[model samples]
Target: MYTEKVIDHFLNPRNVGIIPDADGIGQYGDPSCGDFLRVYIKVKDGRLVDVKFLIQGCPAAIATSSIMTELAIGKTIDEALKITDDDILEAIGVLPEEKTHCSNLGAGALHLAIEDYLENRKDN
Candidate 1:
């Protein structure tokens, strides 16, 4: 079972693509479920000016990734890093207990993206 918000996001998943010149990129996967997510981000003046994702997963994964972009876009790097699994779940409504772990996919990827940016920033 899925929530209405979840269904809406899943059916029309947002930010589904890649940024060839992404300032940062991150990947996260749940091996147990064979779900994988790759996130791309563009930063401007220390803010996430753009965020996108490509995922191989189910409805929950799609919806959460969709909402994660909505939440992270325009946020400063620190704020984007704070976008957590719970933050995503609350935004998209409830998922089945078994699928709740899917909520982690987005925020995890997003955090990694930010981390990647920070790490690369040191080199620039």
Candidate 2:
């Protein structure tokens, strides 16, 4: 039901916690799928110096969230925004068709986090 990469990430998820002083935070969930993903970002000089997640979901959701951080960290905000669901699927290598929606949780959250960061920055 899971690929080697998927199993590995699920078993030992990366960026698996929160950033207490995060510069930006975003969450995404599909109630029907019972997956909820929250992402946090720390930016410096317009680069994503750090990224983290707190996830309540299946193995696929956890794996996607974990992999998303690995792909996004160190990227500039513009670059991060360019990360798409296909990018995530390719990074993970493959995913079950039924679980594909899990792939979006990470990208969606990252996008929202960046948006939140940008919006708040504009306010001040």
lDDT of each: 0.93, 0.93
Range of the 10 consecutive residues with the lowest summed lDDT in candidate 2: 27-36
- Per-model clash counts, in order, read 0, 0
TM-score quality measure for candidate 2: 0.95
Q: Any idea how many clashes model 1 has?
A: 0
Query: In model 2, what are the clashing residue pairs, if there are any?
Result: none
What candidate 2 gets wrong by more than 4 Å, as runs, is 30-33
